[model samples]
Target: MGIVLHLKKKEMACVEYSFHVPSLEELVVVLQKGLKGNFADVQVSVVDCPDLTKEPFTFPVKGICGKTRIAEVGGVPYLLPLVNKEKVYDLNKIAKEIKLPGAFILGAGAGPFQTLGFNAEFMPVIQIGSEHKPAMNGSYFAHINPADGGCLLEKYSEKYHDFGCALLANLFASEGQPGKVIEVKAKRRTGKLNFVTCMRQTLEKHYGDKPVGMGGTFVIEKGKAKTHIMPAEFSSCPLNSDEEVNKWLHFYEMRAPLVCLPVFVSKDPGFDLRLEHTHCFSHHGEGGHYHQDTTPDTVEYLGYFLPAEFLYRIDQPKETHLFGRD
Candidate 1:
């Protein structure tokens, strides 16, 4: 029998069905079956445990200014620099130097070579920076960039000479806590945007102010998107207008399998939080900052999501105009 939860906030009511899984392996098996188009959407959210005093993982969102040790991985300190025209740190080197254990460290940021201009998705399994790039035959090619760095797309590598990135990262240690599994299935054919929106709305209505961290693989049966690659350099005063940034972005019509990692929080956590930030990587070598999904119909997404216990904001920029935000 499934446990039913009635969550209400601001007069809005949301109902959720909770399931208990014996292990992570079992969760993967369920998600894999969903990917075969058995379900339009499948999500496993972590259950809230009031008795647990410590969070399962920590997320370091926004700008990375190497000076701060926002979090740690395997007892090693993790740092991100304030990258700009005057500064460019070797992300690969940084990952290697950390000497993290064999664990999952997922993030999205600007890089490879900032000057070349490109966005990156990192899925490094510690000690083996597995960077995936686009290969010739509609497939992805894997390489070791040492310390498992982020994968940069060649399609977006344009020479702009001015670029900077406020990277968002999360570190999940091997011994992190696990929560109850909340699986959400779509009743009809849905687009990625709507599917994601449903997932977020459901979480918000049910979980209310509690923050949730969701990560896992999802297959995009029919994909359509707009992606961006960062410029190589940036001025102290950078362009923030949508018209200006649009120049660096490109459109695509894709059909591929992808992985998505996102965090959802209904209420502000007293920090500079994006609230909803998601990045995706695919085996087709087609990925960047996922602006949106324009796929019309028959767009299916199957994923397994888990809630995060804590969030750590790091190196938040004092100036909002740098990215054109007032």
Candidate 2:
């Protein structure tokens, strides 16, 4: 008798877009439209948006994302989905006796895949060094301090090496400080190296923040906090071609201290990854398997390099997630 192999498709993570209705009367219309579009289990809730002018953060609305301050309006519901906010997961849970006022929000979350795809096509610009720390555009809620309501994203500074909260100052309007810093424990999966899974695992340590998508140029997980010497020749270095770029990077590998490699991703699953270290190139998936000799900086198979125009901050990847806010 032949053996029947019953195969089950893997339940890969999925993301989708959310919608906004102007009034309670529009809820049914939106829900009917969504169901027609094949979306299931439509849910609704109330949320209040902060007045950026009044609430204090260099960027106030950014302090709240994902985890909504769910509110109810006259027995109706709404939601403020800030998919753009940087989140560490945990948002303060308002007391049961408390209630929120109705706020305006047009749309909800989109598959980070869709979101990042949009970013790659339209907005691929990123900054080097802490000058504006453009990589950190997410809301400050990810770095909120539980003890004192401190937010770290508002205070990262390259000058004092304050890295947001290098001064260990208050993040929120409270008086308490971070109770203590504790390192999160990590365990690697056996066999194949899964970069996305690994990154997601580390981020899971934080209560509220989770990755929706990655595109263009980004750092998944900061490898080290220490900065290595950037070659003086780097200023004049041209990353014009793979060959030229490889030589410049080779100069660092043999002498310079270890630096963080900025990773790039594409929508295509095949050539979806790139690691531009000592001559990096695109890989099939997750930069392929981590070979015994494979180093963090090398993303390509042939060891080619990317030109300088594509290079991100070569100084050091942003290791500190949240810093003390002013």
lDDT of 1 at 213: 36
Model number with the top TM-score: 1
lDDT of 1 at 51: 21
lDDT of model 1 at position 173: 20
Candidate 1 displacement at residue 319 in angstroms: 2.3
Model 1 regions lying over 4 Å from their true place: 1-103, 112-194, 231-237, 321-326
- Per-residue lDDT of 96-130 in model 2, one digit per residue for the tens? 11111111111111111222221100010111122
Indicate the TM-score of model 2: 0.21
**Stretches of model 2 off by over 4 angstroms after superposition:** 1-186, 192-194, 197-237, 250-326
Task: State model 1's lDDT.
Answer: 0.35
- Give the Å error, residue 129, model 1: 10
Give per-model TM-scores. Answer: 0.52, 0.21
* Ten contiguous residues minimizing lDDT sum, candidate 2: 72-81
Best by lDDT: 1
Model 2 Cα displacement at 269 (Å)?
12
Query: Can you write out model 1's per-residue Cα lDDT over 258-307, one digit (the tens) per residue?
Result: 54444444444344445454455564555554555555444445443543
